[model samples]
Target: MRQETDPRDGDIIEYLDKGRLRLAVILAEDGNKKRYRAVSEDSRELVLTLRQVTHALPKQLSPTLSHEQLGQELKSIRLRAEQLVVNVDASDLWELLVGEMEEVELSTLADLAHGEVSAVTCLSTASLLRDDTIYFKHRKDSLYEPRNHEQVEALKAELAVQERRTQSREVFLETLVKALDSTPDERGTEFDKVMTDPLLRRYMEMLLHLAVAGENATDTGEACELLEDLQARLDHRLKGHASRKAFHLLVELGHFSPDENLFLLRHQLPAEFDDVLEEAAAALVAEGPRRLREALELGARRDLTSLNLFSIDDLETQDVDDALSITRIPWGWELGVHIADPCFHIAFDSPLELEARRRGATLYLPDRRIPMFPVSLSEGLFSLQVGELRPALSFLFEFDDNLNVGASSIVQSLVRVSHKLDYEGVEDRMEHGSSALDDDLRKIYEVADLLAHQRMADGAVSIDIPECKVRVDDDGRIWVRQRRRDAVSRMMVSELMVLANACAADFCVEHHLPAPFRTQEEPDPPMDERDFEHIPEGLALAFALRRCMPPAITSTHAGPHFSLGLPAYTQATSPIRRYQDLLTHFLLHGFLREGRVTIDGESAHLALSQADAAMQSIRNVERDSGRYWMLRYLEETLDQVREATVVEYVEKRGDAALVVVHDTMMRVRVSLTRRVPLGEVVQVVVNQVNPRADTVAFRLAT
Candidate 1:
């Protein structure tokens, strides 16, 4: 159906030049290999390889033509090809040929498209195929492949988006400029005025994304450019990276609150349960009681609900993780540390587990508590609610009066809390007198104090720094409370938790089970009591020994934790909150129940990797959000002289010193205009505080 000519010297050919087809006439053949010197359509001279030549037209022209004549001939051929290009309906040609074959030669396309075989028809068909985005793609040797329906639709969607972006960019920019001059009355206080527009919605979302990702953004798109140009128009002028600029712009546009919890967005910690995940959680919550009842009835778990178990937490605590019970055994004391077992319902790598694993741990912010599990389960089923039967991973420790652990064992159990006690209530009872459970509380504290002394003898470095719990009320009021570490209730709870974790780690090691063990390498230079005897028990002194303490790591291997004074340990408490602890429960529960592996060593390490990736972000969001609220509190107390103690000089960051506010015990960095000795208390005035930016600047009041 088609014919073509071998190029001697005068034939014109269609060839690829920078991915576009162009008409070029052969000026001379270079050698026996078919390489030729040719003049392109624009009369540029170049050597053409055979691979570059799309095809040779059957028509020939004079070989010894002048450069001007060659240019004229090329232009005429291009004009005819372009005119014939309009006649080739590419979509129709695709419809005709798609059912026939996957790929077709250029001459076949020409015959199908124009009902004839000629240089003009071939050139026209190739040009149409190259230019059309939705129909076909160029294959090798002048073969063109028609995209399938799905591929064509995908290309059409992409091209449509590109078209919308190209068409909307200038228009959106114009609307944004108009918005800058718009008064509050014109748009109303509600941001729905601007968010109603789809383009502006995308623009604001991109701004949020850029602000969250900052320099780590994989692609800034035109968001930064648009922001830069907006700032340029404002003449209110800023410089440097556009992330901060984006944040300020959102606030200016009234799209974001001044005290927006940006850390939540920046870290992308989930703030609410997704619908599908929430449904799964509801199903699990509905099934939880049945599972526990069956386990208890079948004697699969220890029925310890009859024991006088007690839970101690803060007054506002709902998602309780651990409860305590104490009873005297014949040989020694038996202390039961019961923990809420969320993994009893959560399957391995299930959707809820995956979400919890990605979340790393429950996040406690000043104004919000982002629960790792949905509230349907976390605060309801999995929480050790008072007087309710709940599944638990219980650790029983048998110890002598000397605080010596004689024997320790872990078991899955069902527990009913007999009493719910707050830290203050427990501490009040311990300090004064109580009518009920006085012996149990005192015995537990006695064991805790004795255990602490034993740990001190074992070279444990105990540094208890008081924390500030900041809360923001619905009325925009900030409350900061000094949480003391010296409370008897807190101290005994801490000691017992450490003991349970140590025993759990020992259990894993004894059984040679793979669990998430928390280990810390020894400090380069060990710290002793002498490091603290000189400094007062203030901010820097609290960190005297802890400063040298290495960070604890969660791994599948058993190792010594220098800070805990334990040869090996793992964190098995807070399974309701920490995914690592959930992983531990899974490993232990599987082994203790079926003597089989649910999460093997490889899977434990994989969960550790996934949790590690999100744990740092979770921690960063926690600390940063706390600081944001603390700064907001201080913002209300601006220009007030507050006492701050210098913790240490942060030379690595700048000429600054970290100081802890005496009232709140919240640590912040202050720029040093004069030398300040470590642990030196100074009066400072808060000059400016922006919680959104997490900036609090202070100067010496003296």
Candidate 2:
């Protein structure tokens, strides 16, 4: 039965041409094992080898005869296929060929008879019929067809799963809505309470303005005044009476004095909440002396008769950088600002300092912080402590109410801090109408604001982007939360810093000092101002081209930073964490005390090279950390599908794009075709989100 040959059997013919017959033992039973040995080769190899015998065979013989008959047949096969060596079995070549031919249709056989067929053709009539049957089976099994009860059940199961997922999201949103509804009022006098909370002083400062909107009102303003007053009271209640209404009333009624500002800033509140600002100031005053003493032991030199100091960190023995001195001169009272020489004390090659340099600056995170200096120095001896004499490089300038500096002095001096202060305590007195330190601070703020206003008016850009902040509870669960910045906190810090930066920059430039500038440049208004709601493609295209174009001068006045609305700015505060500030301190110290510039043209060139690389590394690290936190935050909030815009798209090869979610810039890989428009919102299904890599992959949902 194994070897029988029939002329009509295609399998038998194929076996006769390519397969070899073998003798073997066969056992047949319930449990049986048999062994057989047979010659086997690839089907393509067998056919090619057999084709070699064509020329040698008789002209009248069938063309399918074996290649061994003719030398010419062997030569032709070798020449045609150099890659494959073809060989045929001695015994079953005829049977195998005949078996292979069994499924060929009669019409195809007739075509072969007419010399119209090629053995190596990719598709055969036999294969076509089989494919059609398979396709038909697949179609019948599809969900739309549902050929059987089991398949129908499976389809229903899938639909149910989708419905449950959607319902889960709806439920989550409902809970969120309930939480919002439970709040008594959206805006409340919690601003008053913030004045007492150290960490929340800035937050309260912003609310106070809203709280006292109509303290003084005209008869014509009653309608508007009543509405604002009601709103203020409502907000105050919602905030749980965070604002101090009685104190605010005093100031509004002109019964408070500047003396009250100083008193309240220093006074302790009822021991209910931990005031971060007062704690920070106390820490500075308490621990700053310790750090300064260490600096002295390390060989720092200066007279300590007049320094004033403060800290923003809770005392934890960290390095401190700022100190101040006030001196009485024959002409007038002179004020000097001094900062610690962290670099000098740290040494050129110490591991601690190297790490600090690599970090470029300290990074402030929501729940934790990464300081540039070790806690020992950042919060301790190097800090300027109240009532403790410390050495410093100070800048003294003579200016009156008009805020013009005439005669200035820079000297290495020793000084002591009279008191520690914070934004909240300061703001409390400012609005409550106090006189303690009001005149001095108000004067200072007026100068700072004037300088900042000039910069903004000069085409500097400042954007007010609100942010959501995360607060954690004691149990490691996320709980209290609020918008990140308020007006008083934002403007006060901004104006003061800008003025200091401008002064530092001018001083450096006048002395031909080289320093890293905190520069902002204006982008075309169309590019910066264009909203996603209706983007102007022409403007976008032009902006992109400009970004790609090289500049003639790499360093030119960017005019006012379109973002900050400032013509020029550079930071000269917070030297402990910010590298620019530390370097500025170094340069200013030399110019003021030694009458010399620290960085000349050559040194500046070298500093820029090192500084640029350091800055890039720091930015990348910061971005990566932020991305990681954001991804984790999203995973927890995934059930809530908040509306978002498409801010950016990263191009990739061959039908794929990485879409950046608006605001966070979290990127997700997505399939792309010519159909998708850039910077347009489209619903997407998130398949995976990885916090480790800070990435998300999604498919188009609609």
Candidate 3:
């Protein structure tokens, strides 16, 4: 008896070729692996294994036949199989065989289909089964497996979807190609009308998502395929990251703004409040006055509108949240720090409060501001504007002429701001300019100086570094102002806020209440004398000290803030700008009113985690967006050579080092041929700058 693996010369065979069934004629036996040398239907010569052969029909030809004769014979068999397959309904055959059995032999299937078991019928049956995506499958040998009803239905659905996707891709490609070729004038109104189609709109949205996520996009398969298609069709070569190419395409089609803020979108930081949040803010504005009057009538709230309270901030500041006051008593001076009461308006866990908690802090972008609260509330109704009576959580302290605190207290009060002053104006007048409050400004600076000396004596670490503030107007004009970090009026405001925060935090500890207490541990392996002796440059020295300090973190438990030299501290000053401050305000309010914290330690810890996560994203947006605009500034003034100070060298040979540009204050690594000493100022040219890519380079001026 002959084994099934044996194939006679010139036997007709059906075998798998690249996942498709192809008809082939066996020419000779290959003794190795028990495979055969064969000629396929396309007249291509190949070796086929016994496992790959789905069928070896009971038919033969002369072994001495020429190759052309074999090709002619294979073509005739293929033609007959094609003609027979026209009448073979795969689904109909499956319906007949599915209920009776799971599988049937190929020759039996061929006999069932054509009433005969021959090479022609078997090849025809195999061809029909191979092409049928649903109903039947041939895994191995000459067996045909009939799929169950459920499997067949699923396959049909999948096949239908694939067909629709194919058609959709074709239509989308045609529409995009036409749009890409359109004249600029034709693209504006008429092309926008074409984008009204839902399918095209979906494509534009996908591109926008890809642009925002950049290299981090998850659904990149379709995005990559779409771009590859575009690259094949377009005249100019597409380049750069896949996301940026999508961005370029969107800009070309007028679907996206050319200068779209991808950072905001990628971070999911909302640029504007929706209608619901606006309504919540509007409701707060409407209910604020009534609630203030009720609290005052209840008699725990103090009324200090008669006090000459004044706020100092930048000229462009709108959400002025804190003000200061001083008065002489028999033994000492009474100093008052009154903070605007936004937390008093927002109920705990309300939508507005939750949103504030989510934002963590107000994001100040170069060109715009995204406030923690809606503008109507943050800038208008809740801001401590001059001459307007507003509810405040006021911290009062009595200090001697030496500015030593004798006593301090916290109270919910009502106050009116008498003056709204800027730092520059106050700084100018405190020195010599004669203004009505010049004397008061001088006295406040003296208090600030006293507080600073006290903190330093308490082991405070002070590092002052000048920062460049960049602003872009609606007209697209860029203004860069260098701010002195230790200016007198600014210091006065800073020290006063620190005093209030420290005293409030002490109160929380006294009451054993949990709040958002900002804590910073001392620098590990703290900087010593040798660390400071190395850097002589003032800016570099200050920056190195800053690097030695550990970052401050917020917690539900109270602890020392080493940098501020405060035994206890909480940020309750900028409720208008920071969410954690507002939360602390809420905790303070409940303790002041009910003699207990409304939020437990666990709840406060949970809020801290959420706010910390949000604040990280906020910081990334601020840093990345800030750098982008700085790069843009460099691009704007690329012709000018900037003064860059050599800060440090990555290699001791000084072939590569980091430098800080004088005007932009951007620190970047530069390749250096000359051995530049530390703190040496060198003229450097803007060798390369691309704001969108967040890339910039500097080279020493030759």
Candidate 4:
């Protein structure tokens, strides 16, 4: 007798323990004695074993029953079990099941097997259950046997339906992805043929109408009314805000305007749109703009009063930049720093104001800009240009022993700005202790340093990341240059700007005006840890220990930005391009004049939300653009023998990984890593560079 294999789901088990029918292909007797059968037990589900009979058993009790036994006759029949080469009729079962029974068939089992195929396919023909309509795939808990024709047909029908539905969904998703990648023809128009096809359009329309009617419409007239009401409700929610407006701006650039863009941006209603839609867009654009400009111009026309005169320069434009006034008021000196009233120049419903509202703020990119306002206003009329008299809100801070702002006063004053000094020259004189602006400017720098130190001592973390400064020649070819922060060039400019911004925020909050403050929320702890994966095990642990201290408070009000370690941070310095700063200027100007901040708080809040979204979107665009250029640079450098250190390792999807080269932080896919430990120096030859994918591949050389 052959030894039995372990009885797995597909393994045949013999039950003829130690004699008589041992090794026999055990057959149980039925009413038709000509057919034979075997049975197996499943012990886990019941106290006594239950059997799955190989062939159909008789419905009635066998004559082997006795008088006493017949009174309590068993509901099931038992077959003498045995081991036989488990065989199943190939014609009766799927090939996927019994094909693996022999070495010849088992060789290609992976290719032949499918998720839905049965395991009985591997069995030989001798195991046929022809007299009984046997179910090769036995489902537990089902009482009805496959011997019943209706049950067999029902199970097959369910499987077929499910397969069809799954295939249809997959086809639909593939088509959608393809459509996303498709570009329009030379005419720059893409028709939604699949979506707007006559048949699909009619079906969709019917479904939409049915859905509306189901929500309490009694008759056709009532249904139409309900639909109109629902449409109005949806339109209100879909009204485009700054974020969606900016997205539409991009779509316009791409030559593809979605429905959301059409509905919200009626002003840019394509020439194709009927006159009604165009008029509606124009009206919306006009309303908010008209109000904003009326307010701005009112402030701009005023003159500075009750303040000592300061030098003013008239640049070719009058867009307010900065205004200064010095006064010896009573016991101490008062310095008035006035800014232009942009809110005055921007009308509530003007096109320029509407565009500003859409953009939230100007987006600064490496090579270009998507400005928040039209240049005519941002850099011209509303600008507090050098030598031009413009209205501004002044902050007079009284300093005593330590030069700290002990007492402060805010005023709305119309004053002319002195010469506009760029950071480069202003910082140079201060660093050299030059007498260009008196020693007073040097004293300010000294106080600023002290403030920065205090911030760092309070557990602020500072990470200095290098940026690749690209200098593009006239031909548009980039010259990669290292842009490192210098004390006078970068740090000083940053500190003063922060000081201004912090002051502005304090002013707004103290007066109960809703101001858009720039703040950063820290990443979650788990994500923070994951970002350090490429670091060496030892160094990573050291970094983790150093930064393990919990932050005192998640929110910061005043003092140095814990992130930058600078005291008194704010950014009111740039009004020409940034709308937030311009708006801040407006609010400050209003508070100076009225003793309280003016402008709609709700509108300001909406503007802030829109600006943040635009900021993120622009950042993504910048990062991708920089990466594209970096890849191009690497492709050019591939031929030269370049020395690099392994700075990091990034795990890519299966069978692939990225190795970042030190200094440049450029990543390359390397095909070998079985022996190389992370951070260990290994030479590599650049094998291929794909500029299109923005990726490079390298061969690891020992």
**What does candidate 4 score on TM?**
0.46
Q: Report every candidate's CA lDDT.
A: 0.81, 0.43, 0.83, 0.44
Which stretches of candidate 2 lie above 4 Å from their native place?
Answer: 1-338, 343-355, 365-368, 385-389, 393-398, 402-410, 418-425, 433-435, 438-443, 467-475, 478-486, 524-568, 639-702
lDDT tens readout by residue for model 4, 288-404: 346434544676434555443332332222344554544544555444556555554454434555555556555443344445555544565556655554545555556554545
Model 2: per-residue Cα lDDT over 43-108, one tens digit each: 122221221111111012223443233233333333332222122121122222342432433234
Best by TM-score: 3
For model 4, what is the error of residue 334's alpha carbon versus the real structure, in angstroms, after optimal superposition?
A: 7.7
lDDT of 1 at 497: 92
- If ranked by lDDT, best first, what sequence of candidates would result? 3, 1, 4, 2
The regions of model 3 sitting more than 4 angstroms off are: 1-87, 95-98, 111-124, 178-205, 230-238, 293-300
Decide which is better by lDDT, 1 or 4. Answer: 1
Model 1 worst lDDT window (10 residues): 1-10
Of the pair 1 and 2, which is ahead by lDDT?
1
Number of clashing pairs per prediction, in order: 0, 85, 0, 57
Error of 4 at 383 (Å): 4.6
Query: lDDT tens string, model 3, 1-702?
Result: 122666778888767778776777888988777788888766777888877776687577665777677778878977898899999898878878987987788888899999998878888887788788598887556776888889998999999988877776777777777877887666665447546866656665677788889888997788788788878988646578899888888777776666677898899987788899999888888887787777777765798888889999999999999999887788878889999987677777888888888888899888899999899888987799998768899999898877787988999898899999898888778888676567767877788899899999998988887788888889887778888779888888999999899988999999887888989999999769687787875666776788788889888888999989988999899998998888888889998889887889888888878888989999999888888777778788988988877777777674788887878878888888777667778888999989888888888888
Candidate 1 Cα misplacement greater than 4 A, ranges:
1-167, 173-202, 214-221, 228-241, 252-254, 400-404, 528-537, 649-658, 666-678
